[model samples]
Target: MPEDVEDPMDYIRLHLLEKLQVLLTTAALLAVVYFGLGRWFRPADPLGPIALLPGGELGKLLGIVVVLLVLAAVAAAATTRSRPEGALMTALFGLGGVAMLSPPMQTLFWSYPASMQSLYLQMMAEVLIFAVGIMLAEGLGGLVRSFMAKICPRWLWTNTLSELSDQQRKTLKKSRIDPMWDKNILNGDSLSVSSGVRNTLLWNLLSLSLHGKNRTAAQKQVFRGQLHRGFGCLFSGVLAGIVLLVLLLQSPERGQILFALFGSFVLAALFAHHLFPVRTFFVAWMIPMLTAVLFYALAAISGTGNRPQYQVLPIDWLTGGAGGAILGFWLSGRWREIRIFEALAQAPPE
Candidate 1:
């Protein structure tokens, strides 16, 4: 007789419903901000020329995006009833909606008179552009994966998971530990372990409870390896940002707060990785994420040329370092791998 399996789908459905409620609540809050507070802080009179592409069109675009998002959520719920990935998709849709609506948030901060319908229209247009940009980003990720699979079939999971030969299966069975069949695609690269450690570190930082190890000394090695690998990742971000800045060199009133916030996120993540060599959930995921959010807020404040914003960036850095350590430690426990935090925590006290 087959063993009874507990359905994860039921839990997923419940979570999806909860997320939908949260989204609806957020939408209600936005509506209040747009209608209530926006009336009091009206900005300058409409002095700009109206383009052939009107603002109402932008609002219509947002409505279209909302419809598409709803469809995605429905498809995710229907297809992934029993899968955790399905629930994750639902969350992604909810987050995407929030990002799409963020451009219009500034309108709530200030009031506009009836004469400045053009200003409101311009705001709506900007919101649509921003939403489209974010959507493009999400689409680009999928496009890259598609291209990778087509050009490097062996590296893609599609080919990696092909039916195994009898000899291959027998060889795999002989090993005491489970073999990573995907490793074959890497052609025995020496950096594979380091790469795995780097990827694991990011995941661990996000959720300290992901599958990990118990040994402390080994975990420390993994942390060091991840740090080494992260150097490349860090530089890549800086390089990409610099390149974008260079290409779009116009001083179009770029918000200091945005840069500061992003900078703080990077700083915090780096700090967390270096400090708090403890393997617990609280330290890794919670600290880093909180630090990132705080950094963003501080950067926003700093962009206004407010002096207090400078101090918060340093705090963000420290929190990030703490988060990294906590994440490293927790990852060690989850993956049964060596991480720096685990090693330090397990060290003999003097």
Candidate 2:
């Protein structure tokens, strides 16, 4: 088993009922937000419940998506350790949340009414808010990971003489591992030696403690450093989206603004794929999800902007967030092999 298995889902085998409860609880929370947002942002002369292509029809399609994938999650739960199950759950919950787009969320309005142009602007702005917020949360998680690292070094343990293969011995020779750890801790044929240190992580959600000294320390640093770089991707994405939103806001043909929005998502996803090294991609996607839940409260406080009066289907915040999340998960993964690929591709300047 890969040592990176510290997330809540890792405990599925340990606590099946708790994981089930968590899933159901998330679904229940989203349900509350669904009808609650429906009433809060409903139109004055409300549109029919079953109306518009992107409204009810798109929701039905997403509902189909949720149903199909949820079964996948159930099967994944039955496994000993399904690595992809985490990603599957991320997609399921992300899409499941977005699948509940009601008429209220579909049609937005400001202090006055929102023009078609303003609606696109508002939508893109919501995307920015979500993109930034998720990255910020991730960065915070990273900080917590690094903080836990100081305590982790105390729990360090080393493997024995027989445990070290020819390859492992060669690996150990070049590193900073203490000779004392290997010599003083030896007894007979035991593989590893442990002192009076707790082997579990202080916070599993942020950092998972691995079984060995080298692997745990190495992966924790990877988690800290790699997660920090996601902000660069986040900055690039936010900047690209903002610049496009500004330029398009002035254009006479407002439909073109969606191209900017689409391009923004595509560009951001590409940057993250290339740059944000993921020991785990599920968290990257998971962070940016529930955009509607994250931002609807803000919209309520600031007052509404653009409430669509027609039988129109404006793409809501969830579209960018949900779609972006799925795309991010699909595109990103561990970067170790990527480094090898880079080393082989070309040489550095002399």
- Residue-level lDDT of model 1, residues 285-336, one tens digit each, is 2332333334334434434312323222221222222223232332333222
TM-score for predicted model 1 compared with the true structure: 0.27
| Cand. 1 Cα-lDDT | 0.32
Model 2's lDDT to the true fold?
Answer: 0.35
Q: C-alpha displacement of 256 in model 1, angstroms?
A: 18
Task: Report the error of model 2 at residue 56, Å.
Answer: 16
**Candidate 2 least-lDDT 10 residues:** 191-200
RMSD of 1: 17.6
Instruction: Write down the worst ten-residue block by lDDT for model 1.
Output: 188-197
lDDT of 2 by residue, 1-88 (tens): 1232333244234344434443564465446435553344332335422222212243433333343244333322332121232223
Best by lDDT: 2
Model 1 alpha-carbon miss at residue 179, Å: 21
